[model samples]
Target: MPIPDEAAASAAHSVRHLFSRRSLHVPGTRLGAIALPAPIGRRHHWHYWWQAHFLDCLLDEHLRDPAGNALSEARKLARGIWLRNGGRWLNSYYDDMAWLALTLQRLDAMEGRRRPRRRVRVLGDALRSAHTDELGGGIFWNTTRDYKNTATTAPAALFFARAGDFGRAQELLDWLRTRVHDPATGLYLDGVKADGSAGGVVDRRVYTYNQGTVLGALVAVGGRENLEHAADLVDAVSRSTADDDGALPLGSSGDGGLFAGILGRYLALAVSTPGIGARAAATGRSLLATTAERLWTGRMQAGPGVFLFPPRQEGPVSLSSQLQAWTMLEAEQACR
Candidate 1:
């Protein structure tokens, strides 16, 4: 079934009411709160990466309907993030910075301005700096740099590709291909430890978001080999990660909640990007449409005019989980 734009917009509005809040209580603070519900204590937490995804979703809403106020909301959230991060954008996690940089890049692109270029450059440079010879040449996960992982490197590659640094992007993707790709499952592994405790040991854990970001990076840095790999990865995800009903695995609350939606986001990208193969495109579209339909059908009313999605239908509603559902709906809408 086709997912309508209204459904996606409703998902966006629901999330905004339930989770989005001003970064601070002070006057003129742009909306930027990502918190739990009242039942869950409504505590405000600072998750740099989650805020990045929230901003991206706002942009998605704006793009879906240009006449709406979502752009204004996105601008506020951007400012809120900047102010909340102590008037800076750099963070300890390379992956977090990369995600924010990507959304900022999109904002810049949509507005036809380079206003966020400086921040994007700062993030791109930080990602570049994180790439070292350690652990077979990939970006480190955090500032401590004890491990190199796809969580950081894949998105970093995507950020670089979007920033017109194809060379660096290709370098990062090559590192993943050599060090992190698991031939057995046709999916990428998590990361390899570079610390003394587990030096050079591969994590071997396959995550939905990692596959999504890698698919995005592959499509962004398009070539015969990369496109072929992208097609194979899509098929692998459809075969391995999805249930018979086409619903991808819903991760736990907190950061894990965004996993399936992240995969959905890039799967939508694969569906739209040219030369990803017709089979892969169909696979991506079917997965997104089916999963989004399921989520929409299963949504529960939290209160009057407040609808939220549980983590997996039985789990508690968190900012990440609700955002994940919204993201999947948006993905399906975009593909449609």
Candidate 2:
């Protein structure tokens, strides 16, 4: 399962190219923004959530080349995010903030930098503030408070668990279990309306990142029960998410492009988790290896490590898509 050195070199070149073209140094702010590359047609611009994934990619690149500037670039991006929000990491979207907190926590663990403690605390408190008893207790997607989604709640739980706030993490876990989880499918549903009067209609669509963040949270706060739940989730996604050729489908370029890579990362973690059954671990590794091979050999075209999201051909390159592929490649190597 060692990634070909050519693949690793290609990934490094793609990541560095992305930083050069997409990253912005906001004058007078510590934030180095990774803005969306220019459009060929209709496209999203400057999504705040993407920077967190970018930092995660930088972490992978740093692991590949410790002597490289990945750490310095990550620090600048972290500070830029903080400074851009007017000295606060909190934003209208709690989910967006939670992603940053999670990334900062990992960056801090890896680099032991000075600012993450304060940043994580501030962002963590903000995430907790969004949770309410409205829909039987889960976090809303944004400050508007209209929806309680796994996208927000699961990552919030992960941040708390990773930051050692297990009590808060369990609160999120409890809410997810009783509310949005579809026991029949062994997967969490998409979301529910936050309005109590709406009777909490849960959207049943299964997104890979939602499943992933939940799995990651459970892994952080480990126990036999949590591991069992993680295994069930892996079973469900492994059976359901692949396309005809057995390549995992990341639905589209925007958020969908990152979904499977997110799952791949946690799946790798599942493989390494002690006491998880050997069968589950083997399954996880197989999924990672297979998906990485497909993406590396099939979807990548033109530029170094540039991946076209499945069926789409014409548009600016999706930085998220490329980052996710790099994550898959990195996870494949690390887990092996």
Candidate 3:
């Protein structure tokens, strides 16, 4: 576990090159976004929205129509996923609804095809449902208030922001602010004990995604502490998860989609606020380019970097990663 200089340097160069130019030239589409993944990509979670958000930013600000031919596929995949879901949760669903809803919202802003109305409503309801029977303190993981995890809250906030339900989103945000905090390290507690605050905590390890979730959520809700805390946490996660290039390391899953999506969301938030460094925008670009290169070069576009267990069972990456990759690119454009 030394470190990979080539990967780090290459990624760092991506940041410097983009920042120097100051804009992306990505393709602009009607909302379909980009091309479909080959090898029967799983609709497991998140269509292209996660990645599409990044691409939209790129097109709106940086690249030159990088997603022209892919919009049709993007739309098809997006529509197909909703068509079958009946515009609602399909069990085992965790934090994906917000991801999808945000995608729809971004696509709506991009405006073009005018997808199914119920599809939008369904995502709307799914996001609102995140507040179902709030435990007098905050939202539950699912229909049951059995356990509360750290990761879901940020997506919850993003979903609400996109839905125009800022009030409810703010409440949940407030609850999360108090509940998941760790007095020991000022880090989030990760998981809750159902009736208590310390039990069944599977992943207490603070990862970039975990903290990114916070930054993304807080930024969406407009909280000062959340923003500062997110920035601080990001620095911590970055120092640990990121390699020399400022790109995240493979131990944190990779330097591609995970890096792009998580950091891209934070970057977008940072760009909106004043005083962020030029490196922030550049790093955002570098990550997206790296992410795109990953998708473009990996497996047959199907089983590329897709993995189920991750590090444990390499290969066969997930659709979420691709979606995350797409989003970072979109965010990169926005950074400019």
Candidate 4:
């Protein structure tokens, strides 16, 4: 069964009400708490990439309801990110910068505004510069430039494709195919070390978000070949990740919490995109619907108009977990 529109909206509303906080001194800036019922008197670590995903979720809400305050709220959150990141949009992590760049591009396109274009351009340039011949050609994960992985490269490919730099995007994808694509599992490995004692060694760990970004990048840079690859990836994810009832396993807290939801977001894209095989699309849709139903069923009420979502059917509540559930619910709604 498809998730109801009201349920998705309620999840969004609860997330905003429970996690959002405004900076008293900064006036216009706002940031999300790292956890719910935020721990008092402790210094909250600012998670750059997590905030980027949060911004993307806000844009998802805006697209769903044009008349709502989501766009304005997104603007404030973007501003907050800038302020928190020392007034610069470019971050050290190529993946972090790519995520922000993608969200900024979406914000500009949706609002018909040019304000984020400069930031997007800077981020794009940084990502391009990070892509070198190291590890047989892929973007480095961060400034240390010691590792190249699907987590960084795939999103960077999608960003370039979205920005009309298809040559660069395809180059990145080609490198991924050569270096990280696992033939047996049809899933991507984690990354490769650049200069350690274990240099040139493949991590070989499969991650849900890595598959999600690569799946998204392939669809974004669509042709007959890329579409076929995307379909195969969809099939691979369903085979390897889904349970008997098609629900994905629970991701861990912190960054892991967002993993399955990220995959669900791209799975929705595969379901909606043209030219993907029907079986692959059906597989994507079934996983999303099943997981969303599980999330809705497992939600715990926190207060009037606020609810907490675990990363899976059961776990401790954190901002990342709640955001993950919201991301999946929104993806399910989009598929509907």
Candidate 5:
């Protein structure tokens, strides 16, 4: 079923309003950059990863309304990310660096400017360095190399795809399918820990973002099989992750808070893919539409545009959740 244009427009409007209301100015950043608050208690420090997502949101807004100040806002956030990270885009976590690199690439394309080549090279090197033969293959979650999880690998795959390095992206995806994919579920597991051995301990937990990132990777790679697999994952997640009331489950605070929205981004991609079957496209659309509807009805803050996830103990209203909500809305618009 087609999403009513009114629903899409309302969500977009709320996103703009939420952004204007909740986005906060971080001290010492460039003129236009702002940070959204994390959960209530730890809202003190900005979640660095969320800032990367923020840039993506700004880009989406800019594309939707080019005359708006979205471009300037994105540039400010990019500068703020640099300044806040001690004048470096590279971070301790390879996955984090991968996300920043991908976002910067998008910013560069939109602005007709290039990010420093050295920064891209260093970031790519760090991500590639983290790949090991552990658990039969996949990138480690961080410098510790203690585990290989989808949280890290999926985004790394996306970064590789965006860089026009489909060889590496496919390699990562193939390894993930072999090592951690749950065939029965048509969903990828979290990851496994390995010490240069076969079959390390596996997390086996399902996360919306992991499926989402792979969907995004498929979008970039654009093979028939990849699109088919992406559609399968979309259907699987729709059936498994959602509750009886039609709302997708919120992962948790911190990283989890950002999960559904991440999935929403790829779900949108899947629906928009050329040659997508009507059934698959409808599955993706229904999932996003219901999730957004439930979220808006159940979680909207007393303030006009703000939204708060339940089980408030998670922290002050999280910037991560805010971004997640906005991403879902942006995605809904994309699907239409």
Candidate 6:
């Protein structure tokens, strides 16, 4: 499924417009609570939605190789994910490994390629190993042997859903709602302790990404008739996102480039909900269009057909964000 030289160049040139040089610091020092200098800043670390967002988008455009397979690149990206070779798969579902799971299912459906049968079993084993009743029932960050982070848990739930493991998905969603969701804003707090309460925990912030994640999870579960306390979860997201101009910080700002990737995926889910009505969908499209335009630099104008990223706020647009933007845009088009 490798793109042909010409088509690949077109894809490369179009996508390259978003790349900019930036320094990602690897930590040599550790602060009290936060992992300063952070382990892996930007190398080989996949985005929150490479497949679900951009690569998929390119496939929709018939640009991901003339053969129409986005799954190929997805597998290629999986190789770079944290736990591919004897280690754990990244650390959370929100970004690296979780993103892989989200697209893997659809890609499998589309192209029929899997992680081999043995590989699938291995992932399944890893999933069971990672689950615990610790936080009343949330999956840990790594494969059960290590720590847990709410950041990774939500995506893991989505991954389970993608693979048709609905039962496990349900358990994770229940734990998230009970443990991290704050009823007031429909927004989720960061990681919770093993006991499942925000109280006495040093971490307590309603990030846009978490809200998007929890919202997407809620939407997924809400489809079932008898799911306990489903309506309220949707209501929370609606209330939190509603407001005056710029009422809340948009997770995917137009010019954020890479950061926009998170917003792109969340907005796609928010807009796709069946009963949400047309108004919600319109607003979502408007937001995505704005972000795309802002992130567009004059990269394509260069001679040999080169795409460059604008060194805006976050330096240059990230490759992942471009894919996310493209993927979300494709989803929007299909809905219409």
lDDT of 6 by residue, 1-336 (tens): 211224333434355333311122212210110111223433444333342344344345543345643445444433333232234443433244554455444455565565434444455556666677664566666543334556667777766766667788778887776777676675677765544453324257656556556656655755644122333443454456544432223233232333444545566666667765466566665554444443342123434564433332243334543444344444334334
How far residue 120's Cα lies from its native spot in candidate 3, in Å, is: 2.8
Model 6 residue 74 distance off true place after TM-score fit, in angstroms: 4.2
Q: lDDT by residue for model 2 over 49-102, one digit each (tens)?
A: 877877777777787789988777777777766655566677899989888888
Best by TM-score: 4
* Angstrom error at residue 256, model 6: 8.7
Q: Scored by CA lDDT, what does every candidate get?
A: 0.85, 0.74, 0.47, 0.86, 0.73, 0.48
Tell me the deviation in Å of residue 113 in model 2. 5.3
TM-score quality measure for candidate 1: 0.93
At residue 250, what lDDT does model 1 achieve?
77
> Where does candidate 1 have its weakest 10-residue lDDT segment?
33-42
The TM-scores, one per candidate, come to 0.93, 0.88, 0.61, 0.95, 0.85, 0.64
Q: What's model 6's overall lDDT?
A: 0.48
Candidate 1 lDDT over 64-169, as tens digits, reads: 8899988888888888888888899998898899899899899889889855578877887898899998877999999988889999999989988887789989
lDDT of the structure predicted as candidate 3: 0.47
Better of 5 and 6 by lDDT: 5
Off by over 4 Å in 3: 1-70, 84-94, 112-116, 132-136, 183-189, 195-203, 223-226, 251-260, 275-336
The stretch of ten residues in a row with the least summed lDDT in candidate 2 is 27-36
| lDDT for residue 238 in candidate 3, whole number 0-100 | 46
The total number of steric clashes, by the backbone 3 Å criterion, in model 5 comes to 7
Candidate 1 vs candidate 4, TM-score winner:
4
Clashing pairs in 6: 16-307, 17-307, 17-308, 53-327, 54-323, 83-88, 93-152, 130-144, 254-291
By lDDT, rank the candidates, best first: 4, 1, 2, 5, 6, 3
lDDT of 3 by residue, 23-61 (tens): 111232222212222232334433433333433333333
lDDT tens string, model 4, 1-336? 546777778888998999888743477777887776675643667688888888999999988888999999999998999888888888778989988988888898898874557888899889989999877899999999889999999999999898888999999999999889999999999998865553488888999999999999999999999999999999899899888988887665788888988998888987799999889988898888899998888788889977887644343357788788888999989987
List the candidates ranked by TM-score, beginning with the highest.
4, 1, 2, 5, 6, 3
